[model samples]
Target: MKMKLAATAIAAACALPLQASADGEVNIYSYRQAYLLEPLLNAFQEETGIETNVVFAKKGLAERLEREGRNSPADLVMTVDISRINELVERDLVEGIENDTLQNNIPQNLRHPDGKWFALTTRGRLIYASKERVEEGEITTYEQLADEKWDDRICTRSGKHPYNIALFSSMIAHHGEEATEEWLEGLKDNLARKPQGGDRDQIKAIHAGECDIAIGNSYYYGNMLNDENQREAAESVRLVFPNADGRGTHINISGIALTKSAPNRDNAIRLMEFLSEPKAQQIYAEANTEYPANPSVKPSGMVAEWGEINPDDLSLQEIAENRSAAVKMVDRVDYDN
Candidate 1:
């Protein structure tokens, strides 16, 4: 019975591409905010005359896909975080895509080894320091966050956040667990307050003079600057690219993949290819203030304003592989305790 079900699903998928109308729509399960993605979807529809439908949720798209099984209507999945994308691949819910356009556009380190997913945008894990308190060049590396000088002067979001967890995982990838734990301890000792709030809140704390330095994704700075209410929250802090002379800046991505049991495989492939194109990539970068996955596409003005720095070039898979261990270490240190 299991064999028969698998055969039927494959047969359905094989038949889907051939039957998919040029004008057929694609349904997307997006973990990203809808406003950030709407413009690109609109452009895609304008170009292809194919409708684009999306279900936007902050979490659980993976479980949704798994539960829906072969009957799932989702053609594509879009999400942030390497671990989430890896989860889809591990569950056999994501299909491998091979396209010359994708290969030529996205760098190898940013894409999955099996072509299961492709990063669309990149965000640096950067430091934000109080302009009045921390002079330029005072903190130049991520390692400096552990220095005694920053004691009780640093703020950050919860370690449980995927962004921080991924950042910690990258540290483990570069440094051994012992060194990484020691660094975390130093950061903990330096905390202005127990980790609370989102990345923006950390910046708010910096603006309020509660902390002299904070860690956040570069795009959050852009987002805060773009928001009317949060503009005040970002006004006092300046962005810093850490480790510029060493391993390079740590980074992560917002990425997409095709669902393995997609009822609209052809539409899924088309959407993926479309996203890789320069126009779509630019829209993504501009809207989110993230570096485009396509090297040929330049970052938007806001991202460019942050200046260029070499990314660490770490394989995103390394972050995913170390995620569990990183979480364990966070608990071991009683990061919140």
Candidate 2:
């Protein structure tokens, strides 16, 4: 609920006191790991001869930007979830982008209305069930997870998780508070264990026979498939695309935005445009196993193997608007209880 901005482009050349050069250099602050974003940045540098500098952290970059203020050296910000993006918007940290290429490449739902941020890649919140335990057709919809039959057979991360919270917000948007609360209560009763751990841990619990079903994002599945140690963790379970018959699967994104006070404004805009291009989108998909936000880009083989899915067409801003209500509802149902 704490709102802050990620990136701002400033006009002042002497803001940060760092050495400035017109050699086409851009600085980026990212919530994602360096390696995941390195390939694209490296490719951008390779293609445009722009020097790219990056600082990566899982949290606190917003506060860091706020502290740095006009003196902030950051020219661009990249992070996951609508909450973080909304924070940037609320704090007036990100600046409006005027690029036509970005506008054409990104769908309206995936970008800020003011053109401050745009989703680069997406992850879906889908069902993961034990292949040996749960029958293939036994569960399909997210609504069905609340059924009494699944009691003590479900595993999940904490409700406070941004992924779960966002999914919950989407549910609220689709289903009224009363219905969502009822579903949450049922889900809480069906929980195999109290919420804990990341998505991979939930899947690992399923493989361990600790639970028959779990909720997770698509990228974690990809990460598991790619990791030598956790490959076995994904082998015993099947991924299910829920709500295919209705609102479609709930989805979230890892996105980028230009800071309002960006020092290297032209370079930052160029980076935004570069990321929206098909090749960069493909690099994001192939490297991270995420679906490209650009509809023109095909998902990588790993994601394709997971099967095709229809994402909920709801706007990303709707998810941000409903996040607080979703968090309150989670607490009301004592989802962690």
lDDT of each: 0.84, 0.85
Compose the digit string of candidate 1's lDDT tens values, residues 23-128: 4778777778666787888888788776766666667778877877887877888898787888898889998878888898889999998899999998999999
Error of 2 at 327 (Å): 1.1
TM-score of each: 0.92, 0.93
Task: Let me know the TM-score candidate 1 reaches against the reference structure.
Answer: 0.92
User: Any runs in candidate 1 off by more than 4 Å, and if so which?
Assistant: 1-23
Per-residue CA lDDT of model 2 for 1-337, tens digit only, reads 1112222333221232342334587877777766777788888888888877666667777876787788787788888888887888878888886778998999999998889899999989989999999999789899999999999999999998889999989988999888998999999999989999999999999999999999999889889988989999898899999987778889999999887667888988898899999999999888988999999998868898877889998999988889889999999888987
* C-alpha root-mean-square deviation, candidate 2: 5.3
Candidate of highest lDDT: 2
**In candidate 2, where is summed lDDT lowest over 10 consecutive residues?**
1-10
List pairs with backbone clashes in candidate 1: none
Clashes of each: 0, 13
